[model samples]
Structure formats: structure tokens, C-alpha cells
Target: MQALLFEPNVQRIADETTGPITYQPGVIAPDLAASWFAALLQGVDWHESSRMMYERMVGVPRLHGHYAADDPSLPKVLGAALGIAKAQFRAPFNSIGLNFYRDEHDSVAPHNDKLHELVPHQPIVLLSLGATRTMVIRRKTPPHLKTELELEAGSLLLMGWNAQLNYDHGIPKLRYPVGPRISVAFRVRPGWSEDGW
Candidate 1:
């Protein structure tokens, strides 16, 4: 793995085992990221969500929303971001998932994305906004080695499809207080229905 330090605060992470993962901070610039964050905070139809975990309904730590490729209701800010991702990554992304971490308490468990729903060979692109947070990616098999990176405002993390099959990633909760953060994940799910996954 080669860590290309672009600046004091920005770096790129890539490893052979993890496939083509790349982290580019300042991809959207500070001012633009902040503006997009504010717009998404207000424009998105955010909702408190829960999932059946171990046969019990438990609330997810963050607010969530999804936008289909052709959905007229897709927020302009997100649509623009998708455009950028499409041009840069050249992935056929058709869906956008948004997760709003209100503070340090909000988090996501370490798990791979639903592979069946994603287009094969396409990369999953994550655009980070607002506060910086640590994202941990761990090996799925025994030994469970892990890598941690601070995802800062306007950063981009591209997770290759092969990486999803071999590792799990998440944002762990922090004990100390931190500002809000929002992540926009762009994925390609061909033949997606109105009833999404």
C-alpha cells in the first residue's frame, strides 16, 4: 500500500488486498462542501430508521435517505455530486444513499454493502461532508487486521467492488462530542425497483 500524502491533512490510501480504494481529501473544496452540506441538511427528506437485527427491531444510529437515478425528487446538490462521481470514477451509478451523523454518537456497524444489489465490477463512491470522522475498514476473515482513516470534509473514498467482498467498513461512534457529518454513497444497482433494498 502506498500512502500518497497530498498535503499535511490530505492523503490517498491504496492497498493490493483492498483492491482500488482511494481517499482524496478536498475533492469538493471546503466552501463548496459546507454549502452542499447545508443544502442537503434542509432539502433531503431525512428519516429515523431501524432494522431487524438479531430478530429485534433496533433503530439505526443515523438518519437515512435514498434517491433513485431517475427520481425527480432527487435533491439538486446530490444530483450534482453524482454527476461529478460519474465523470471522475466512470461508474454507472444509479442510486444515491445518504447518511446523516448528527454527532459523535451516530455510527454504522462494520459490514459489507449488499452485493446482490450492486452492479458487478463497479466501485462504490462515498463523498463526505461536514465534520471529520474516522472510518475503519477491517478484514472479514480471521486475524481481522484493520485500517483507519480520518474522512474529512469534502473528501472522497472509492471502495472497489472486490474490496466489498473481502472487507467490511463503518464509522464507529466517538466518545467525545463532534459536529454533524453527512456521507453520500453513490452506487450502481441495475434493474432497481421502486421498492429499493
Candidate 2:
């Protein structure tokens, strides 16, 4: 009976699993994903940020943008995408965070979603658009088991709340050339701040 839930490209990564994570491909259809990617790339105001790393301020490799779910300034594609996510996983996701990887040079260091920033027990919904990038998810404890998924455009990945406590995930810089990609991450922010635009 459970098998029926994940037909086609759905993958429930549980073997040697330390956390609950589900990945499904072709959620938005390829053409629509491409169109949405184009819209988000141009319509959204992307920005750069730096954080104190190793006792020095270092520039982040990728661009970032954040928004509230009901913000009037969000592009139409985001609303449409959010509708799909909510329909599939009924969660109280009130925040949206976007990461723009301009090229292979743009990468995020392995890290987990900060617990203080998210509401307890709420899942994190992630949608991938544009170029496919491999995400490395690994256990933070002994044995350090790892898994890799090539997040294709139109794919959706759900990480359970407990997953963050047990694992770390991120995209590493690729040596080969790759097209730009956008990652739209939906979360339930505990105490939301300003993110209209």
C-alpha cells in the first residue's frame, strides 16, 4: 500500500538513513520549471551577503533573497509553486528563501537549517529549478554515512524537522561548467522578520 505513494521518480532515502528525507522528481513539469526559472532569475532582486567566517568577514558564494509567503511583491511563479507545495504537504510554511547559484563557482558549505530560525516539527520544502546540482547529505555523527542526489529542475525535496538535527546538506563547487540554478526553500520561520521584497 505504501509503495503506491512513491511511484515514478520518487525516492525515500532511508537506507543507512539517520533522518527522514523524501525526494521526488518531475513535480512541476520540465517546461514549466524552465519558465519559472527564467521568471525568478530576472523578476527577483537577488543580492550578495557576507558573514563572519573563521574570524573574518567572507563573501558568500551565491546570491540570496527572502520573502514572506503572502508578500505582494513576489513574482507570480512563486505563488504558483507555493500552491503546489502546500497542496502536496499541508504545513504552515510562512517564509520563502531563495539561493541563486550563478555558476559552478557558487556553492554552499555543508550546514543544517538553524533550529532557532524554524518552527519545531515543520518540514522544509525545497524546489529546484534550472541546472541540476548534486546535493551531499551526510550524517553528523559516527560512521558519517552520506548520500548524494542530483537535484534536477522541477524536483522537490522534503526534509523532516528531525533531519536537521542529525544531518548536514549542501552543494559543493563543481570543477566543470554548469548552468545557473535557483533553489527555493520554504520554511516556517519562528519569529518572522521583514521580507516583503
Candidate 3:
């Protein structure tokens, strides 16, 4: 994405007691985002896993990476990201969840972040890098409202803790070939101690 030339598409999808579910584009410049993406693509410890699907165990479509906010081994770029997120929402975010989509073949199943694993009332911040992908967020109740946003590199998406209670979001596999993408998710985890923000 051409961050400087790009027009900001900020949308507040919902307003809840905890916070607002919103998407803000071009939070980082394209040059900085490109460097960070390239470094993180090789820097983070990526993991692959499997999950039970239809009574059978199958590989998760995308790779995952996770880290505590205090760990000294985390990539420096992440610290920079944490500062941006903290400045934006001032929540004590202490966990990082990274999703790596290698290509259009990689995707994530529709689901919400586990409540038991997160701190109440804190918003979840996700920073996108690499290729753009559409994320579908659909409400759980009647009418099942659905919204789609093309998450481009350097954009930031903030979903309130309450939003998870009301919606499920996911990235479905695309038919056309696409490059890799990485999503850096910052959250506040219950009972976790962090040395820095």
C-alpha cells in the first residue's frame, strides 16, 4: 500500500461499553511498513499447528507466532508497534499474537478471541503488513450482520473486547494468487506481567 498517497479509511463499526470496533488505514508509512514486514518475515518464530475439524485433525491454514510483551527476544519492530498501539488506546496490552498468511491459500477460520485468555474491557489491536486481505466480521445474533474490509499493509484495526462477544471475524482463502501477509495482534492478557508496554 502507498501509505502517503493513500486516503485514510477509518470506520467505526461498533461502539460498545468497552471500546469501539474500528479500522484505521495508513497508520504507518509504506517505507517503514515495508522494512518492518521484511524484517519480521524472517525475524519472528513462526509456528504451525493443527486443530480438530469435522472429527478429524487438520493443519491450520496459516502459521502462528506468539510472544509476551516482556520477552527480551522479541523483534525490535514489535516494540515500535506496541508503542503505536499504546499511544492510540492507552491500554496495558501485554501479549502479541501473530498470524502469517503465506499466500491466498492461507486463511483463518471464523472465530472470536477467547475471552478467558484476555483481560476484560481492553481493546485488541491488530497491525497489518504485507499483502491486503479482506476480513469478514459477522455478528452472532439474528440478521447476522456482516462487514468486509480489505486490510492493507500498515493499517491498524482495533476491536473492543465486547466486539468479540458479539462478532466472529476471519479471513477466507482467496482464489487468486497473492503474496504473504502478517497480522500483529496486541492484547492484554489476564494475570500476565510485562516489563514494558
Candidate 4:
């Protein structure tokens, strides 16, 4: 197998008080990205998501799916992809979450990953597939520093363990047309399975 490579111009979006947020473009081989994207789109059991906003429930603009560690039910392609990520990152990832952005309108609100669930100091690895989209990260406190990044297909983002402490990240809605995209986030949660939490 050929070794995976990242773009030379890796960007670090962080400051003195916050943990590192590194973006490595082209982490997946370009030749394989197309096929992998297609397989995941068809294989994962994706569904619309919603959450309580203010006093009312609102539908999230994207689709979502999840795979627990050692889940035998995952499709072969997704399982293989998970294996690759685990080997590449060398993290004890216990869960995987998939977010599908069907078009330019799908977006996620700025927020940090829930820290109570994740094991501290373990980086979260996010792999991007399909269309490129912009991700924004902003400081949670005064000064309110911010940065924007174009998350390209086949890219990988490593969010440091402490990155969540001071910053919030999200994918904002775009007005222009964009094809579908998928992001797979690998994490090491405290629980063994979804039910354990």
C-alpha cells in the first residue's frame, strides 16, 4: 500500500491559551478519495437530525450516523476506513460520528464537543470526503479570535484535546452551490458503547 501524504502547507489555527487545531489537506490519496466517498454515502445509515434550540425543537440541516467501536454491523468500507484512521492517528478511538452535508445549506452551529463524554487529552480526528466546505473556529471569550478554513476532500483535521476549552467550531451555510460532503469524526469517549454513557 502507498503511504498517505498531507499537503505541505498544513495550517495551525490556535493561540497561546488554546490547544492546537491542525488542518492537513490531502491526507487521503486522491486516487482513492472518490471511491471512498461514494461507498460511505451509500453504506452508512444516515438520517436527519434535530435538537432543541431555545424553547423549540429545530431540524439540523444535515444527516447523521454513528458507529461504535468494534461494531460488526458497519459496512465493510466504513469499517476499513475506520481501521485506516485508527492506524494513521494511533488513537484508541472508541466511537465514530458521521455528518453528511447534502448541499450548501447544511451547517453545524458553533460549539465545542461535549467534554464530559470524551476522554481528556485524546485528540479528535476528523476526515473529510467529497465536496470542499469552509469551517470556522472562534474563541469563546473576549478578544473572540476567529479563523476560517476550507476543508478539502481527502483532508484531515486534528483537534487537540484542549482545543475545546477555549474555542468553538462549526460549518456555516454557504450561499453558493456545493455538492454533497461527508465528515467522519473519530473520538475516544469514556463509555464503551452508546448505552454505557
Candidate 5:
């Protein structure tokens, strides 16, 4: 992966909210992404894990889901990544979730990180690898608003307290041909998980 340069610019999608919604570029250096991806891929035991859901258009179980973040090596990579992401975003992240999109067929639907799983107001760091895809962040309520971003390879997107508290984010499916893409979402889950640390 080559070094990626993010032209830091804030694009305000809507007004009368809390604060300005910012979309900063190149938060995650491509070199770090490359090194981390190599470690994540080698360390993770990637497997197909999908939950069946009814497709509105097709009215069928289209396996609308993605791979799980069950990787042993993740904790290590996450530990290292937290430092890098923190320096870039200027915040601390305690937990991380890894998602692997094997191809165009593998994708994630629109959803937010349940407030219960995360701190009341903390940042969620998302790092994209492999290929480019559209990452959509939207306001969950009326005004029916949305902001779309093309997440390129070896890129980092950080949604801080202002963005996390007021908006929801997700990566939607793509129709064009795409290769394997990995996204490691680093967040601050202030409580606990089944895996006792």
C-alpha cells in the first residue's frame, strides 16, 4: 500500500445540530494500514458468518450480513493501532471490531453502534483497507439526512464525540466488482465484554 494523503476538510451536511460534522482525510497513514493489515490477515481466522435477513426487493433470504470480528491477533494489533489512531484523532480508544468484506457480495447494512455497547460520548475510529467503498453516515431522525464518503484503501475515518452522539454510520453494499476489504473499527467501550480481560 502506498502512502495516502488526506486533504483535511469539513463538509457540513446539515445545520441546527450539535456541532459541525467533520470529514478529515488521511488520518490513518497507508504505511501503517499496510503493516497492520498484514498482521490482521495472518492473525485472524477468517470465516463466513452471516445472519439471514429478508430482502425487501427480492423477498428472499439473501444472506445480508458480514464476517465476524473473532480474531485472537486482533487484541495485539488493536493495542498498537490504538496508539496510532489516538495520536491522529487525539482521543483514546479501548475496544476495536474488525470486519472483513471478502468481495462485492460481502457487505454490511445500515446500522449504528448501539449506545449500550459504547461510551456515552466517545470517538469511533474506522480504518479501511484492500479496496475502496462508499461509507455512509446519517442522522437517524427526521430531515432524512445522509453523508456519503468514498473510503479508499489504507484510509482512516474518525468520528469523534460530536459525530457519534448525534449521528449513525455504516458501510452499504456495492454493485460493482470489488476485492477483499478490511475495516477495523476502534472504539471506546467503557464497560465489559464476555471475554474477560
Candidate 6:
């Protein structure tokens, strides 16, 4: 496996490995990752807007994507990182969903990607950049449990099968100040959205 950084250490989150979902921390070389991110931020058109959810699900506000046009270098590096991540965790991934969260108030509520748009048993690789924020992952049950973690810039978080199947993840709005945040979410979704536009 090609290491994103030699001697990179894993930061473990509080979760029962026996309980289906596992969140592992990975790191990429900042300089390299930043270059790709810069290219992406420059190459793609980004908009500040919100998306409404169907059937009263939580809505997503202040987000944008960098996937509407040709991005040769960004996707390659991201795909390579996903490859390493898959081998490291024994998970499979292919496509990437990139989002820019502009500030403290910009947020995404608890929700999972539509199942029909994903491949069963594959994982999602989320890479965070620019600034840090707390990502809350909660299970769907009484007592209403939750786990919150500060995802630092240049950090990678992987959500596997059980997570996608059983839990919901999101970045809640914080009243305090926070800088811009960019998240690159990579996944495997064969023949899902080929219009690529």
C-alpha cells in the first residue's frame, strides 16, 4: 500500500468494533493534499446555497461541489487516497462527493446518501480540509445516542457498511466562529450518476 505519509498514525474513535460501524483516522501529506485542493477550488465553480430534503428529512445548507467539470489531478489523488484507505480498512470505494462548508453557520443535518445511489457494502471516505469542525454520528434508537469528534483540517474519516446502514452523520451548526471547511467524500457507486453534470 502506498502510504499518504510515511509513519502516519491512526487515531481511533470511541466505537464498539463489534457493533458494525468503525471510524478510523488517516492523514495525507498536507502539501500534496493542499495542492490538489487548491486546484479543485480553482477549477470548479462553487455556489453558496441550501438544499431541501424530501419528506421532511434534515436539510443541507451552505454547500457546494467541485465535480461538474474536468478535474484531472484532484480526482486522481483522491482516488489514490481512497485506494489506500480501502486496503487499510479492507473496504471498497470508487466515486467521490466533494462539499465546501463555508463557515460556522454552514451545516448539514443528519442524513445518509440515498441507498439506490450506492453500492452495497462499500464505504465512504471523507477527507476534511481548511478548518476543523465537530461531526456528530448518532445511532437510530431510543436514549438517542451520539458521538462527536473534532475533525481537523487534512484529516480523513472513513464510514463503512454498518455506519451507512444503521447511523446518520452530519456537521451541525455552531454558534461560535469557525473558518471555511471542505470535505471530500469518496464512495463506490457504479452507474449511479453518469451524466456527471
Give the poorly placed runs of model 5, Cα more than 4 Å off. Answer: 1-21, 52-77, 161-166, 193-197
Residue pairs with colliding backbones in model 1 are none
Model 4: worst 10 consecutive residues (lDDT sum) = 1-10
Rank by TM-score (best first): 3, 2, 4, 1, 6, 5
lDDT of 1 by residue, 1-197 (tens): 11222352435454656656788887786778888999999999999978999999999999999899668888888878988889778887889999999999999999999889888889999999999999998877777777898999888898888888888999999999999999999999968766555
Most accurate candidate by lDDT: 3
| Model 6 lDDT per residue over 82-107, tens place | 66666666654546667888789888
lDDT (Cα, tens digit) per residue for candidate 2, span 1-197: 12112443769864324457889998877788888999999999999999999999999999999889878887888988888788788987888899999999999999999988889888899999999999999988988988999999988999988899998999999999999999999888877645532
TM-score of each: 0.88, 0.91, 0.92, 0.91, 0.72, 0.75
RMSD of each: 4.7, 4.2, 2.9, 2.2, 5.1, 4.2
The lDDT ranking, best first, is 3, 2, 1, 4, 6, 5
Which has the better lDDT: candidate 3, or candidate 4?
3
**Model 4 C-alpha lDDT versus the unseen true structure:** 0.85
Which portions of model 1 show Cα errors greater than 4 Å? 1-17, 193-197
What are the per-residue Cα lDDT tens digits for candidate 3 across 45-108?
Answer: 8999999989999999999998888898988999889988898779988998999999999999
Q: Over the stretch 98-189, how does candidate 5's per-residue lDDT look in tens digits?
A: 78776777666676667677776676767776678787878876875777888776566766556555677667777888877778777776
Model 1 poorest 10 in a row by lDDT: 1-10
Task: Give the Cα-based TM-score of candidate 2 against the true structure.
Answer: 0.91
Off by over 4 Å in 2: 1-8, 15-17, 192-197
Which pairs, if any, clash in model 5?
6-25
lDDT (Cα, tens digit) per residue for candidate 4, span 14-57: 74358778888877777677788899999889998778989999
